[model samples]
Target chain A: MPLSIVYYAKEFFRGEWARKFLAAKTAPLVTPTYFRNYPELTGKTCTHHLFCMMACPAPGAIDVVRTPEGWMPRIHVGHCIRCGLCVEACPNGVLRSGRILESMFYDNTKLSFSFRIDVDTERCMGCGNCAVACPVNKLIDSQMSHGGRASTDDLLLKVNEGKCQVLHVEKCTGCKTCEHHCPNEAIHVARLLEAVHAPEDEL
Target chain B: MTVLQSLKNFVRSKSIHVAYVDVGSCNGCDIEVLACLAPRYDIEQYGIFVHNNPREADVLLVIGAYTPGWEGKLEGLWEKIPDPKVAIAIGNCPISGCLFNRPHTLVDPPVAKHIPIAAQVPGCPPRPTEILSAILSVAPTVFKDYEVRK
Candidate 1:
């Protein structure tokens, strides 16, 4: 069977053993590479400090704090699955795994960036999943009504004639929940300034 | 024989080395394996070492299944590992072609067809402890003399 070809390769060539030897030789190299690339001890300071603040549920209270250093992550320690969703989400290599754990355990105070989502008033559906998922309620109600309790009519959604021909006068919070959650990348948060400026410039 | 003696005996032998290959996997399993190395699971205390090179590995622990772009590379790497080597298919993709499995799929070939698998560890990605157990069971002789000195 063609499937047996793999077994044939393993048995006849002893390829598995060779790979092990090669790995043994290379294991030492990986360490040096990691250190040279990351350089934990040098203590080179980060110029830009962004905090990805998270709110943790206390015994009875919710405690919110900004992460002092590194890439601002959406999740916290007990809550992190190490799935790397936040890591991948980071455009900068601010949020990293592996040895970063060692540094975090040693020094709890490090400067970092906090990612804050600003929604365009014209394009948000006001679904509060992002607010709910936010570990530190950073994405809270910018408006008076809380928990996506804004007037639907007040929220304006814009349609790009070239991009999305279909128009809907839907209620939007400009909270960016729809833009962030839209799997198809079809929805975009419309900037309030851009919409207001367009008609004024035309006049 | 008592479990302690059996454990003792298992540590005395020098067994096989395992190497892992990531072929377009989402890397969920990779993170779990790394976690196993941490203080929590501590698979290293049992004598299993994860290797990078394919030539010296006694066992090939493959994490992902075939994608069209990566098929040839996987085959090439599989050929490089020396034998008497056992292939341990880990994760649902290699065994049953889990999420990425489709008839007209880009990288559709099941891992079993690509190599001669000696054992299978099933899970979306099996827990590291489970992976360690699978490795030990397949190559008991190599691990007979294993001792992890803290």
Candidate 2:
């Protein structure tokens, strides 16, 4: 059938039903007898926000729904507000906050900065302090920085070992304490055992 | 009076015609207003329909904040619209004088300052649902059961 024909037929029937339904349902929602005296308010307050979400079928997109049991509120990670309030409110330590920033150039160049806890392959004794301290699941060992493909010997950390003042093994725990606190911003603590990686080339 | 009742009367009588004008907006609000014509937001579900000529239109849906140069044009357009007609200021820029509100900027701060606005819809490119609510609020015949979403 032609699009306009389909539209007119569907719209005509829908309009009749909607008008009848609205006349009944909208009466209590608006002031009675007031419209007879003032018609402008009819134009001024006509709105449809309350019923719009009922049409959305996307799961986890909306936090609240008007179900047969009445309005129901659901919490899902995909629906996160990014406010960090839920993370702080969780009693079982199930939520953890993570941040990622990416800068893209029209020429297809990419620059990104991400912060995550990982082992310092050269010095790590695998004590797993950071993993245990994490609020989320203790999958700290799985939190590889580059990717878990490279071994400790294959990974590289650009460090001036000769200029480094702290040389003693007893003083260095290899737990990334110095890398975390380094003011010069030159030290890059790496997990050599993990995979060495680079950003994928863009098309 | 309840806007809903007046709206139903208007729809039953088939009385109002609306005109849309684009000023200095980023076109986001314009798109939302357009969505009202679609199946979901369906503004035409009521008797309201868009008019090409300002003189015939019962309501002027002004989208975007007016620019300084466009002030005279807007005034002229308002004069062209027939009396008893409502002027609706849609979007945050025209209502609250948002990002386009810089004093030295070329655009006028807000449409309300330049014209006798009948209603204002405030939003940073408000959702179409909100736009529909605002439209129906000003011209009840624009929609039947108007629900303003946050």
Candidate 3:
């Protein structure tokens, strides 16, 4: 049987567990994770130029996964050699090495943390520079009402009135595209680390 | 508290000997770490000493991100440290690879990936004051945990 058929049969018979189990066996020697100390922001500022994805030496190390909100970049730790190329390739400084784990159990959701996107309402002209730069145009356009005519030259972005609002918080991937493209520095994206439940006695 | 327990605490608290290592860094953090022991910072007044040998060290201060070539050396040094040791990553490089998180020279994961990290002080090159305070804050918790395990 072809590999595609084999994969399909496995998925149909065993469901997601077969793949998850396979992922666990090949876990990285050392896990290098990233986190944003700040919490109020959303979505990475990634412009979707995919620079980091290209620079990554490992195949399938960096990929875009579809969330309910939209497509977001995902890091597969099992294949990662702990090379920092993807981090350096990012111009927005969105990715930073955070925790180093001696071992890691397979968890797809735990591979990358989520981000929150916050707009600086005061500084934002609602020019849609972020919208233009965003890889998922439909997600941005669907959320915000277009007030002004779209500009051909992104150099001078103008919004007649009202500002872009992130309708969905969990949808953000923290790619840092909007944060980098904003002329007035209006957008900020931050990662949200899972809160550790400290023991009551420790607290 | 039992007399033996109190005595152990007293002796442990009286002095904190540190071993400093730089894996792959600009040595900016190394200078700042050393400055803490200099007369200007005078950490010795608080019974802190930079012993430079891991066998005598109660605390291991790692100053750089672990490079590909130095993994064995780092592991060897880590093993040489006596038990009840506290490892504090001194700067951003050792904890997060800092600005050198690139692939050209094989600067991959931070030090924590190799050894267990007790605490971390973050900054490209953290201030001497920050390094001093991180050491002070992390030492007690590590010692306490060690005592509990014992």
TM-score of 1: 0.37
Instruction: Rank by TM-score, highest first.
Output: 3, 2, 1
- Which scores greater on lDDT, model 2 or model 3? 3
Docking quality band of candidate 1, CAPRI definitions: incorrect
Give the poorly placed runs of model 1, Cα more than 4 Å off.
Answer: A1-203, B1-15, B141-150
Report the C-alpha lDDT of model 3 over A1-203, residue by residue, as the tens digit: 69999988777678577666533233222322353121111256655545556556555456655667655556653234345555544544445543212112122112334568888899988877776666554443444334433433232223445685665465555577888988899988775544223323333
Question: Residue B69 in model 1: shift from native, Å?
Answer: 2.0
Q: Please tell me which model should have the higher DockQ, number 1 or number 2.
A: 1
Q: What is the lDDT for B92 in model 3?
A: 71
Q: DockQ for model 2?
A: 0.05
Candidate 1 docks with a DockQ of: 0.06
Candidate 2: CAPRI quality band: incorrect
Model 3 chain A poorest 10 in a row by lDDT: A100-109
iRMS of each prediction = 12.9, 12.3, 16.3
Per-candidate RMSD, Å: 16.9, 17.7, 23.1
Q: Tell me the whole-model lDDT of each prediction, alpha carbons only.
A: 0.49, 0.49, 0.64
